[model samples]
Target: MSHFSIIIPSIRARLFDCRSSLFATFVLLSGLFAAGCSGSHDDEVGGTPPATVLQFRLQTLRPEIREIRESITGTGTIGAAQTSNIGVVTPGIVERVFVRVGDRVKKGQPLFQTRKNDYEISEQLARAELTAAEARAEQARLDYERAIDLLGKEFISQAQLDTAANSLKAAKAEAGVAEARLAQAAQRLADTTVRAPYDGVVTGRNADEGTYKSAQTFGADSSVLQLQEIKIVVAVVRVPEIYITRLSIGTPGDIFIGGMDGLFQAEIYAINDKVDMRSRTVEVRFGLANDDYRIKPGLFVQADIHPPERTAMLLEQDAILDRSGDPYVFLLEDGIAQARPVVLREYDPRKVEILSGLGEHESILVGPDLIRLTDGDLIPSIHDADR
Candidate 1:
């Protein structure tokens, strides 16, 4: 029985060893065949890899920058309008000047007076001529009456009577001329004093107590009082010719003087028809009331001309999402969002310009306060977020 047991055990061991070897040979051949099938044969298309999917957003945009025109600033001086230079109209030695520079004078106010010496002499001469002419005229009248009576009675020849009548008529005419001369001399003497032609401030005085002058005082070319009306001043402002379309007569504006901080409102009283060739600007007149006269003449001023009307793009304040102090937004494209930077041209409390960011028709992500977002991040945009 022991021998039979040993034989059975040897038989079992040999059969198990034979099965293990066959399994090992089968696994080795299978591995070799699989490697041979997968190996690269250097074919032209052998290196091709599988297609990949990259998640990204596609945003359409047409951005722009603000068009500015700061290059058009201009500088000019304010001045008084054109006026006549006042001068004395009658001739005499300057006796006394009533007004000096910095004095305000009204229309027809006395300014200066000429010496009465020349006027007195003229009056005396006229009076003497009048007396002589009157005496001669009286004598001629009596002589003519006697001649006429003699002729009527046929006691005098026609030629003698005619000559006597002619002499008398000439004497009367001379007397009339003397009377006119006397009146003119008197009027001249009275008008030797100069007066203001209109209400204005005295800008200059060229006369003294002893200065001799003629009726064409200081000649027609010379000036006596350089006066100007300053009740309302006209600021001569030079606006760039490029703004020609916006500028017109009667446009309202505000002027700021360099030395003062007060605002002076005015209207465009006048505008130049021609542009300055060298300065590339057009001179416009702005009329402002100088009631208190705080804004004096020759003050350098800067003025802002408001545009009557304008049209511009606007967006709601919340629509602009600021990132790192710069206003921006995450624009949606193909179910994803792309962060975009925008420039701010102008914005009030209500709206702002998307100067360089979102396009007209692009979809922008409104909210999700805690959403971590980046360029090409998947986003869900609902038209009505507040709903």
Candidate 2:
């Protein structure tokens, strides 16, 4: 029934038929049976096995050309448009404080007053001296005029006329000195009352009633109040030097202040010309309007500067791979994976702008299988994951 069974019976018959050459016949029959058995085994197993083919199911994407708006981000602090430390110009004991901390003030508004008795006495004395000097000058002028007339009429000696003229000149000089002293005294008296230099809100109050403020001393102890103008605010931010070239005055931006409800619209009002060598960053200032005095100084803030839009080749972030510090991607070429290094213009969590080493409509491998893939590995097919 089977080749091995049929072959064994034939071999036995051959061995018996040749008894004289029994040894030789048996040896030859045994070799023939082994060959037949080997052929049967090969037939049962379906001959030599076919070569193994490796297959893989992977996701791939093509780089796309699209319009993208680039945003440069930075963090900074909010500052008042203007700040001032209100202090006295003259030394005196503070008698009354008209405004307290957190009080809103207008231009020329009274903030505090110092003891004015000493300054008032000096001003009164200067005024009295000025009046007396003016009276003396007027009398000297009359006498000089009479002397001139008498000299012309030959009623007085020329020497006496010259003396009267010298007296008039001396009196005039004294009057001028007194006038200057009176003005100085008036200014000193006015300095006893401190007024707001501009419209602002009081942020600090260092002096209270009965506190002695000195002109010689400086800083908080000498200041009566600290005022800040919050009608407008400035955001001082440090931007990386790489992005500084893309920014200029009047460039629009959005600012996010900590604890604020919404983003504030702003613009690049100032940009520092010098870059910090140590940090390689440039200082930029954005202006924002705080008409209701809601924004305060020293608050933390974030800025998003919107640059002009441009067309670029963009790809999903997953398509790019980081080998050491350099970025790479696996490109599909003729059913094989090829590793390509790419230069990135910019990148976010979702996508990346390909500055070089990639072209639009080029197929690239993506997804988790990328880790297992190697350069020159055969890819049987590509799955368009982007679709």
Candidate 3:
């Protein structure tokens, strides 16, 4: 009975251990089978997905070719059309000053007169000497004629006649010298008075009545008076060298003076041949009529120079992109973004003049979101409205 019980228990324990092992194995296999079924169902529902393509609805614009007249602007100062420093040619004391500061005078008008006492005395002396020389010349001529008659009558020798003729020649030379001296003295006397060179207004007065002025001190700084013709004023401005080719004499423009109302219509009167190396600009002058003496010299002015009109391609400023100091734009071709370099002639706040590198029919992308785009980007659709 003991052996039977032991063998039966051993058999039952072995069977229980086998059943436990099989149940655990079945549970693991069932879990793996469920995972496989789930994976197969997923494969049947959806396979490998397609890559997403980026699409942008971008606005585009075509380059415009039209007649454009660009206005170049610069700031400068107003100057007199003609300026002169009035000074005395001869040295003397200022006896009388006919004009004062801010006095308007005409051409050939006397502005001042120097002391005439010394010059007058010299002139009188020169005239008296001329009279004496003429009398002596007449006497020598009479003597020569008398000597010639005596020689013909055998009363005087040929050598004596020759001596008389020589004396007459010397006397005539003395008279000529006296006449030149008189003329020179008269000129010196006239130079003592200063006259107006042209029609102008006296802007300054450096000398007063009874003030002694010297001829050697006649210059801009030592001028007795400063005269300027303000009936017509000149507006001087500097223009960039790039636009110099389009400018020429008689080009029309406008100028605005500081503290003055309205624009002054003017024309290009002059342009410098050489460009300034430091500023890369050229000096230009415009002439404007100032009939009422409203425009004064040394006043600040702004100039607007209109260049000649020409046919050119212009694009909106939004379309241009700068890459490493070079300007380029994204061109739309066959629904693809293509980058193309461009050469610019001028730049403005709203538009830019294109010199080259763009075709007439080519379209460019322009909008606020242009920075997000790159070269070779696929454009799925273009905006309906064309700019």
**Top model by lDDT, which number?**
3
* 1 against 2, candidate with superior TM-score: 2
- lDDT by residue (1-387, candidate 2, tens digit) is 888998999999887878858778888999999999998998888867755445665778888898878888889899888889888888989998999888989999999999999999999999999999999999999999999999999999999999999999999999999999999999999999989998999999887899988898888767989999988889999889988768989888889999889899889989999999999989899988888888888999999999888788988887778833799999888888999999885466688888889878788998767888889888876687666
Per residue, candidate 3 scores C-alpha lDDT tens digits across 131-197 of: 9999999999999999999999999999999999999999999999999999999999998888998
Local accuracy of candidate 1 as per-residue lDDT tens digits, 1-387: 788987999999999999999999999999998877667444335876744434332222232234332222334555655445666667656778888888878899988877777777998899899999999999999998999999999999999888998999999999999999999889877777777777777766665577767655454256555777776777888987867877777777778777888777777888889999998899988877765656567889777776565444455555566533876777667766677777765455766766455566666565443245667666443453322
Candidate 3 pairs with clashing backbones: none
Error of 2 at 123 (Å): 0.8
Top candidate by TM-score: 3
Give each model a TM-score.
0.54, 0.69, 0.76
lDDT of each: 0.70, 0.88, 0.89
RMSD of each predicted structure: 11.7, 10.0, 6.5
Provide the clashing-pair count of each candidate structure: 0, 0, 0
Better of 1 and 2 by lDDT: 2
Candidate order by lDDT, highest to lowest? Answer: 3, 2, 1
In candidate 1, the residue pairs with backbone N, CA or C atoms under 3 Å apart (3 or more residues apart, or in different chains) clash, namely: none
